[model samples]
Target: MARPVQTPAEVLGIEPAGAYHRLLLRAPGVAEAVLPGHFVTLAIGGRDSATPLRRAFSVHRADPVADTIELVFAEHGRGTRALARHRPGDTVDLVGPLGTPFPVADAPETAVLVAGGYGSAPMFSLAEAILARGGRVGFVLGAATADRLFGVAAARALTPHVAVVTDDGSYGARGRATDPLAAMIRAVGATVVHSCGPMPMLRAVTDVAVAAGARSHTAVEEAMACGFGVCMSCVLPVAGADGATRLVRSCTEGPVFDGTTVRWPEASPPEPSPSVEPREVREVREVWEVREVREGVRS
Candidate 1:
């Protein structure tokens, strides 16, 4: 992994992506270093705004040739709304390719990827990486509605084995993404599963993967006040290799972890100040109409 660098990255473009926005930036160093599941933090609200905190976003895509990176997010709060206001050629302070990346298998194998809403951002690149390694990939994507679900076309372009679900039945099925997960794993004889989404969905994915005896990797959507692991706001009690549960920072030690090892919370905790990971509880329940974010942008 490469060390992170803080730079004043120039905005290359911003466009509407269904209910979300896709931001592109000229971030050579960050873009070059970022891998699947790695994220970046952006200082929001400008230099003299009320919200001084940064927002984190998972990397949607990084183009080393173009020296650019792309991020997908919903402008539901003050910070993101401010970020959405940025125009091409504008500059934003960026820090990243931070956090642990999703570990890819050294040898090609059958795999499945699960994503919810914009959480699908990181999964596409991950799929490409897996495919490049001669691995087979399948995708399970879900959202509240068809409009909210992302990357179906992209996923299809990657592989024919794609399943889509929506809460209201406006898409493939009227259910959560996890609904068909087990069957997908069984169908493909997948040995590995990867996911990026709200906390609850990740927990469910872990359960299904574990039940199917597949190794699972999940990129958590925890709110981070500091993307460098200093604020301690993104800690989650995770079971370590020795069977002891310890609080781990999502920004540093993970954003991606062994799904079977996470100690899932009994109940949804209070939605953290909206900072990074757009597919959290707030978006699931409220549809991202109104919310405040905290740590810098991830994607």
Candidate 2:
């Protein structure tokens, strides 16, 4: 694969969606190569600071035709707050379509997707691919309240069965998203399942999918400071094919993996993913070296 790009992205626009903002950016080659589960890591701080830990975001949508990519986020921290302040024509350094993409490796009759909070970021792309394969998709989205839910209306347009769950019952259903997942899969005779969310929730959804006899895929929400495997910060304990437990970098081995094999915190001895020389590791060391150094950022 061609190496993921480290280029200056121009802000195209930002649209408000309840409590979240869908931020669009122009990122040439990056948009064309992105897959369903891929993400980008942007350098924060400023140009010529030499370094800044990256803030990762799932590729909410990538429009190759427009050479633009979109990310949906809630401003929960300094990184995202900075992202929210960007205006059209502003530039940010980006590195992506990184990480292992959701395995569209199988052709299923029906696919069920489960999301928790911002984990909904990656589902639309996966849904598009599933539809292209002549498969149907259904979503079970859950958040703290109605406003925390990300893409319910957009999801409703993509798939007929979009169910939302909020703890306060301010949305489509009460309780957790997993509450209705198993029944939905069984009702649709779903042959495959995909999920992205908090680790605890993924663990629960994986159990439900396994019990329902549906093949499952997961896009894990692991913190990746490097957006590549070098940082060793985002390790996940997973069952390797050899039947031995191993720790793998979530940035490389996955942001996506077989749900059934991930060793959840309580289930097994947690082994750290072993180190491997990552392929397609982008040369972000010189990020934006070509963009004329600019002075002054927001105070």
Candidate 3:
């Protein structure tokens, strides 16, 4: 069952890491409140103004005993910039535990985790979860350069089997992280692949996984407005079980989906209509709106 979405809590701590900040929030009574792959949505501005509502972020760490949840976000936009200015004891609005989590395949004989840029957040917890379940974990992280490569040390600490790839030669391999990922998968004979990253990297990883006949799951990074499914901003075309293509809302149905389920086009396809008369479309929209309203009231 889904956990009830909560209101924004107070900022407890802000630890800086390069250009990003690890924000610790106190959501009292929300103890043991989050699942491994769950995320939280935080409102940036005051309620009276046209606040950007809530921005969704993956829960990097959730400590129920401490009544705290942590989010690691980069300073990119107005909301994020504002978040950077917040000090301890400041209150911020939030609503969450949204969306389905990445499927945890039981100790997949051998598993490989591939992440790029900020995409490492979700994969980090996922790796830890898998390890706790007795699964062997290997990591392949790609970044623009050594400076942009975050979480390598942490990932390495979790498992000795880690490979870093950078666009520049400042890191492990001079090529993209996918190069090392492919190499590592081949060398270790990885059976399952989990990835979260840029679209190009995801596509590349999908191709590699498909060629190797490995089951792969991908966590997508898309623009989301309503952390629930209401906004329709994060819908992507996916191939359904019936072989027909359908649009799936990323916020609700998935931020993480099986790579094979996505309808990848060879060339740029035409945009899908926002208002289709299909029953499924209507149902999806309705469900999303209801969830949004419920979340709004809680916030």
Which lDDT values do the candidates have, in the order given?
0.85, 0.80, 0.74
- How much lDDT does candidate 2 score? 0.80
Give, for candidate 1, the lowest lDDT window spanning 10 residues. Answer: 290-299
1-299: candidate 2 lDDT, tens digit per residue? 22599999989998888889989999989999999889898876586543356788998999999999999888865667778888898899999889999878456468899999878988988888888888888899999898888888879999878778999999888999899998889776788889998888888898899899998898887656687888666766778889877667778988899988887763222333344423113222212211111111100
In model 1, which runs have C-alpha deviations exceeding 4 angstroms?
A: 266-268, 271-299
Tell me how many clashing residue pairs each candidate has: 21, 3, 2
**Candidates sorted on TM-score, descending:** 1, 2, 3
Candidate 3 residue spans exceeding 4 A from truth:
29-31, 49-51, 266-299
State the lDDT at 6 in candidate 1: 94
Task: Highest lDDT: give the candidate number.
Answer: 1
Cα displacement (angstroms), candidate 3, residue 234, comes to 0.9
Query: What would the per-residue lDDT of candidate 3 be over residues 72-178, giving only the tens digit for each residue?
Result: 88886567888899999999877777777777766546678898876787777788777777777889998887767778889989988899888987878888867
lDDT digits (tens) for residues 1-299 of candidate 1:
34899999999999998889999999967787889999999997567866666899999999998989999999867789889999999999999999999998778988999999999999989999999999999999999988898899999999989999999998898999999999999888899899999889999999999899999999998767668878676766777889977767778989999988887762135444654554434434432221112111111
